[model samples]
Target: MAKVLVIAGDFVEDYELMVPFQALQAMGHEVLAVCPDKSAGDKIKTAIHDFEGDQTYSEKPGHAFTLNASFADVSESQFDALVIPGGRAPEYLRLNPAVIDMVCAFAASAKPIAAICHGAQLLAAAKIIEGKKVSAYPACAPEVKLAGGDYADIAVDDAITDGNLVTAPAWPAHPAWLKQFNELLNK
Candidate 1:
């Protein structure tokens, strides 16, 4: 079983954090859900981002997701893959040098890395998306381009995998996202 690391923080998308965490575990992969500055047993407040035909997605308070590991203790060598769930967390997480460094480490190792929605912000900040064919929430297109990555603004349920990276627009694309991510891990 692959040891998977999931990066999350306060306001991370509810379904984005829970579904992959549980699904990966059900598939027998060891998944570690963590947040910066948070230790094992700590809880992160999650937000529910739902589409309701508005100009933008709606956000609502969600459950607290518990972290099973400590970010300070994380080592890229101990994990086979990295998962970055999207939400408001990415906005500030991208500003953290430690988070960027960890992301760079994962990229350097060419391990499977999956990101969705605003999670791509971290990748953009790490300067690892350059020349990559990436897909993320439509709102992140400009950032992706600024980072020198090719952005694919496709359907909400579509996901794109390029090399060791898999990305999608949002949680609705979980099926495609997880499937591609699983294939990458098994490779």
Candidate 2:
């Protein structure tokens, strides 16, 4: 089974993070869920399905051993692939130097980097999309282009390979990310 590391921060879309993650696990691949910080008690909070509520909810950060391992502690030699889930998580994760290095390691090793929605923000910050062709949330199109990627209107499931990169528009269109990501992972 391929080892895949899922990088998520707070406000990660519940479906976006949970669905693909479980799907990857169901496929018999080894998956690790990593958040920021190395803690035994620190928890990442996620709001219940509403983006505009003052009552954002959160699950107590998972057990430190199971909750998060520092991005700084990660090594490219340890994982086979990377999947970035979207949400406010991207906005914050993009700022972490360790996470940036982790994202860069994926491309540095020529591993597939799959992202959706605001997840593209993290990719954009890592400068991995330069001169690459991919797709993301329409709102993020300008950002993607600024990072050197061509925002594609095409569906993500379609096998459009733009120089070793894969893209999906948003969380709602995840079948495409799933298809394209699985394809890249198995390769």
Report lDDT per candidate: 0.95, 0.72
lDDT of 1 at 153: 84
Backbone clash pairs for candidate 2 read 43-61, 157-176
Model 2 CA lDDT for position 46: 50
lDDT of 1 by residue, 44-146 (tens): 9999999999988999999989899999999899999999999999999999999999999999999999999999999999999999999988889999999
lDDT of 2 at 72: 48
Give the least accurate 10-residue stretch of model 2, judged by summed lDDT: 57-66
Q: Given candidate 1, what's the lDDT at residue 126?
A: 96
For all candidates, what are the clash counts?
0, 2
Steric clash count of candidate 2: 2
lDDT of 2: 0.72
RMSD of 2: 4.6
